[model samples]
Target chain A: MQETPRIRMLLGLADDALIHGHRLSEWTGHAPTLEEELALANIALDLIGQARALYQATGLPEDDLAYLRDPHQFRNVLIAELPNGDFAFTIARLLLVATAADLAWRDAATSDDSDLPAIAAMARNEIAYHIRHAADWLIRLGDGTEESHRRSQNALDALWPYTGELTVGIDRSAWLGAIEAVLERATLTHPADGWMQGGGRDGRHTEHLGHLLAEMQILPRSHPGATW
Target chain B: MTNTPLWEVFVRARNGLAHKHVGSVHAADATMALQAARDVYTRRGEGLSLWVVPSNAIVASDPTDREMLFEPTGSKIYRHPTFYEVPEEVGHM
Candidate 1:
């Protein structure tokens, strides 16, 4: 079957949101404090919401797109599936992704495409909070206790490999150039080329994704059409 | 490893309005308390101003004393001017 370019692009977005939301949800009941737990949960919910909107627009049920797919079918980059290593690591990951996602969505919200702009606008406000919160924690953790500083730096180093594919914008997508320009304006430093990793978008996932899907999909797959 | 105390949240929705009780959250300190309150309470833009008080520092009136403390204000009928008749041109009165 010939895949439409729109479906493929939308799949990339939904997959990214699904994988990252699953990763963030791992911090639930285990964050450094009650406030942090709530924050992570709220961010996860927003990502899930974005994924649902994108998936539904792409002509698929969000549940089927999120839970029914096999691990090999997922197009999310490898970084989103990596395990949450520590509090600092989690914050660091959030800092990086939220900053980039925030930039990308800002451009998306202003795109020539009608529906895409509206969806991106709605997502931008929530993503702003996610970026600020994560960046605040990054500064605190990076400058705080000896342990915290070390952990965050290590997290950045570890996650540095997957940064490249995130910026590999789809050539046919009109918003790519604008989004890249906005992200560049932020002046956030990504690691050098030798350090940048790959394989998430190619459907080559990390070892972590299987376990992540098994757990995230269990309830929905088992229930099959259950709704609140 | 950090044991930050809980904080009480109060929100002021508009400039002329009084700050009212909201809820509480545990934070590393007061600054973080304010940030957390903003994230948790104002995510939907519910507030224009916020105050974070350490949970331990708040003093309270007894719940059992509610009638004695609040009833007196309600019983003062003369506090309101129900009997007054206003002239037609006195619009606000």
Candidate 2:
């Protein structure tokens, strides 16, 4: 069957959620506090839920799509696959990605495609909370003590370059404006536009994604054709 | 951090119901406390609403004063709903 642009878009969104959700789940036991650990894990579960719905919409078994796909077949943007560095880095990355996702899902909720719009509508409420959670952390960490402020600023600067890839082929003004407003309130500086990294949407990714996929795919691959 | 305050959580299971104390979580502020409550106490779809208040805000009668505070109610059998009998035709009432 010929794939529609809608299917491609759905795949991109799903892959982004799946990969980032995996990274977020990695913090299950290691977060700064028990409350934070639960919060991050909850957010991770929400993303994975979104991914499962998107995968099901494609008329394939969700597990097959998630666990059997090749690395190059993924369509998530570059930002979603980056390493979770410090807590500051994770917050910075989430703030940027969740903001973009909130905008994208808000638009997708009204899309002409049947499954995409319904899935988007169902997922929008969850994404809204994710955005708020990330935004709250960003503001707190950025405006916090001297060490926190320094670390947050560094994370923002380091991750800023990858964000441009998210803006491609989408109306970026809303995303940029939302991010600017948060940065302003948080007292964090936005990096000036310069050289921007690209290519994850085209199946080219950093080494981090490959390592992540290896761990995630191990169980399913080791037990091919086995069902619980 | 240990310095973070503890907040007691209450969850309302449905509309027209009172929020009942469920558990406690630690957070730096009310906003984080609310988020923590939603994440911890409501994960099983157990709530229609949530409230988180700082633990210190609550004033409880001393445990040593249990007899003074609560023991008297136990002996008041007349206060029990079963103490009165309704005709069978009254059914639910």
Candidate 3:
């Protein structure tokens, strides 16, 4: 059976939020400080909340959608699944994705579709907080102690390549034009010099995503019908 | 201990009547200081606004100095009501 355009759109939204949320959750007990640990957990919750709304919009049970699918069935772009390397790397990813998601939602808030716009509005508010939290870290790490500064720069460089997939601007279903248009407007007009790195959309992900997915999907994949 | 700087956090929640001291977190600098404060104190939608100030910026008196600092007028009888009568109609005290 064919899925509706709205369903397809909703699935993409849910997939992105779920995968990212899962990735963030891995940092729960591993952060360098108690404060950072809590911050990462809170962001994870925000993404999960976004995923729940998108799943509801698509008429799918959020739990089933998150846990029932095999790896290949997932459509989250590689950036969402890339491993969290270090505190600096995680902060870099947070800044990049939060900025990207904020831009995407800014356009989505004005989507031609009724329900998606409302969902996007709520997501936009949450994204604002995410952006603020990550941006502060970005600035501190970017301009802090010599070691921190080096780590932040390295993190930005490492994560830069995966960010390309975030603004692919194409949807298989033609119904997503509004979202695409919004993305174009929201994407950073001129990313700071030398920050444009590409190649995450065509499924040629970095080695990191494979390992991350293996560990992340194991619990659900091993016991397909199990509930926690 | 001497090398570490202290920070004080003030949070204003959405439903709160005033900005109150929530808790504090330590960081190497002012920017990280504020970020740490947010992460430490506002995990559950507990803050709409936040302020972080270096603890050293505040001036405080030692508790040991309390008597000399505040005892000058303690014995002024006029400062306390020695006796008073409440009318029966004054109601609950």
Q: All candidates' lDDT scores?
A: 0.76, 0.88, 0.71
Instruction: Count clashing residue pairs per candidate.
Output: 2, 0, 0
Q: Determine the TM-score of chain B of model 3.
A: 0.63
Which scores greater on lDDT, model 1 or model 3? 1
Segments in model 3 whose C-alpha atoms lie over 4 Å from true places: A1-3, A170-228, B1-4, B13-16, B66-93
Q: Please compute DockQ, using alpha carbons, for every candidate against the native two-chain complex.
A: 0.38, 0.82, 0.46
Across A1-228, the per-residue lDDT of candidate 2 in tens digits comes to 335776677788999999999999999889998888888899899999999999888887789888988888888988888888899999889889988888788778777876888888878898888888888888988888999899999999999899888877666888889988888878999889889998888889988999999999999999997877
lDDT by residue (tens digit), candidate 3, A1-228: 245766766776677788888889998888777767877888898898999888877766766677665555566777787777888778767766776777677678888975779888788878887777776666666656787777767776676556666666533133123223322433312123355444433334456656666776678788876776
Candidate 1 chain B, poorest ten consecutive residues by summed lDDT: B37-46
DockQ winner among the candidates? 2
Residues B1-93, candidate 1, lDDT per residue (tens digit)? 356788999999998999998999888767778878876887676889999999889999999999999999997888898878889898884
Model 2, position A131: C-alpha lDDT score: 82
Interface RMSD of the candidates, in order: 2.2, 0.7, 3.2
For residue A183, model 3's alpha carbon misses the true position, in angstroms, by 21
- For candidate 1, write residues A1-119 as lDDT tens digits: 23477777777777888789888888887887767777888899889888888888777666788889888888887777889888877877776676667666766777675467877
Model 3: chain A TM-score against the true structure? 0.78
Q: TM-score (0 to 1) of chain B, per candidate?
A: 0.72, 0.88, 0.63
Query: In model 2, where do residues sit more than 4 Å from their true spots?
Result: A1-4
Candidate 3 positional error at A142, Å: 2.5
lDDT for A223 in candidate 1 is 91
